[model samples]
Target: MLLRIFHVSAASLFWYTAWYDQNFINVPFPNKEYAQYALKGRVTFLTFWCLVLQTIYFTLSVLNDYIGTNADQSKHASLLRTIKDTLFVLAFPVALYVTSAFWGIYAVDKDLIFPDWLAKLVPSWVNHTMHTFILLFIALELVITYRRYPSRAVGYSIVILFNLMYTIWFHCIYYQTGVWVYPIYSVLNWPARVGLQLASTSTALGFYVLGEKLNDFVWTKVHNKMVKSN
Candidate 1:
């Protein structure tokens, strides 16, 4: 809807601005002029991804009856799932905001004027690791839900469709503006970028399958143990 459009537009903007200003425009893709959109580009990129993730989760929930299931289950399991889900949902957007804000601050004050302790704590490595973990968690959750309702081919279809659309949208934007929201896309040429996108998407699907298997395995084991104790 309206939110989705805004998110995609914002993420696209942020992504282009970050790349054009940081690296792309002056050197290889010099002909590609995007400075006009650079200021809002980073914000756009972040917002788009946030919306994408939220849409994915919401769609999945509706498809899986999560939104309409029995109230009893909610009373029993809602708290734990809510905490994890909220964190999972918030993690990426927060990271993007922090990164954008930091870059903005740095742009204004060329020198490292922030408190030494705070500056030291926010290492690039840590940020990278955290982002990776959050993305993995998202992939895992998707996989788990997929496993929970494997019989529903429609659910899988929706997931596949969404992922494909996202990939296409990402590549198209990168090509048009010469900016990549994720480093993997930016570092690779077109062929490589396409290959990486396909591989990453497949890997995420694989992780989802693995998560489903693990959940099944664990539940079976726990059930057997309980029966034995009884």
Candidate 2:
């Protein structure tokens, strides 16, 4: 019951944040250059996309908890479980990667990932909500739930497919706007850009592995407690 309440509350929070971020319109930049990217169609951003993903994951999770399972793990549960598992496999690693990559770059050079002018416009809370709180929320989900991770081949394939699709999407955005989705890409040459892409994909894959290991370790402790109680 407590976990169910947490899922409902988290779903509401992510939904609110994602909606506010999408509809937010405050022109912090003086000129059209930054305004075009900052206040306009934001789906081009991986961070925003991840926020949307988290929103959907939590919403689905609430539904799954309420009606997805019974004493027998019924057919309804099986279907919802598959969908939840697929979304979790994608959402967990990608969310972690985006948060890690965002803060890592911000720590070294805010301009590269988030510029000063942009920062002035977006609220500090919104900034942390999107980048920082996401990590905490997802990590909490992992600690509270035991998800059966897909096999390495299946998981890696899904991760690679997502990265590849986003790679194409951002490149298309660049072709259209004459600007990279991230400023870091603007400064890198082709070889360096390729290397960065590979490194990022690898980092996300590592997070997937870490999540699986953590899940197993956490549930093992939970199982022990139940056995001891019995």
Candidate 3:
């Protein structure tokens, strides 16, 4: 219960900071470009989904407690368990990837990852809120909870769909404004653009598989301990 609340709170806080900075503190007034604010990019999309996933889990927890299920592993066909499994399976990799991509790019050239002008407005703490601590929060959740992963087909399908959607969205944005969302995309020629996109998609797909394997490993140990206790 406490951990659920903490997860919900942390996700909520990240949303607050993201919106407050964009809608309130941004210079020259609030950002009016809806595409710029759209949940198309990784950071915003993942953060948004984290809040959603946490909220759903929190509500499910409350519902279970109210109905006196109390975390029973065998109840209502494990509906809550299934939902949480899918949620974490999808969310874990994305959150980890977001943090890794940010720092990885930041290390190479901060400008490529984050445009300097917007980057200057954001403090290190805020940057970590979206990147670093988000990963930590998900990690803590993983350490405490055992998630039963769905099949690899389901997991890989979702990842592919998500990456495709975002790629299309960026293309649409470019079509609409004759400018790419990230400056890096604008400089790339057709072949280079395709190559970069493929590399990124492959990286995300790798993370999806990694998350599944990690979940299986963790929960296998947890289940073993539970069996031994019995």
My TM-score estimates for the predictions, one after another, are: 0.41, 0.85, 0.77
Candidate 1 regions with alpha-carbon error over 4 angstroms: 1-147, 152-155, 183-187, 221-230
TM-score leaderboard ranking: 2, 3, 1
lDDT by residue (104-210, candidate 1, tens digit) is 65578734423455445445433333334334434444333312223325434544565676567656666776666554455678798678767655654554444
Local accuracy of candidate 3 as per-residue lDDT tens digits, 99-189: 8978898899877766678677777676777677767877776766666666788888878887787788768756766766566776889
Model 1: per-residue Cα lDDT at residue 63: 32
Candidates' C-alpha lDDT: 0.44, 0.78, 0.65
Find the candidate with the highest lDDT and give its number: 2
Clashing pairs in 2: none
- lDDT, residue 140, model 1: 42
- Going through the candidates in the order shown, the clash numbers are 11, 0, 0
Which candidate, 1 or 3, would have the higher lDDT against the true structure?
3
Candidate numbers, best lDDT first, in rank order: 2, 3, 1
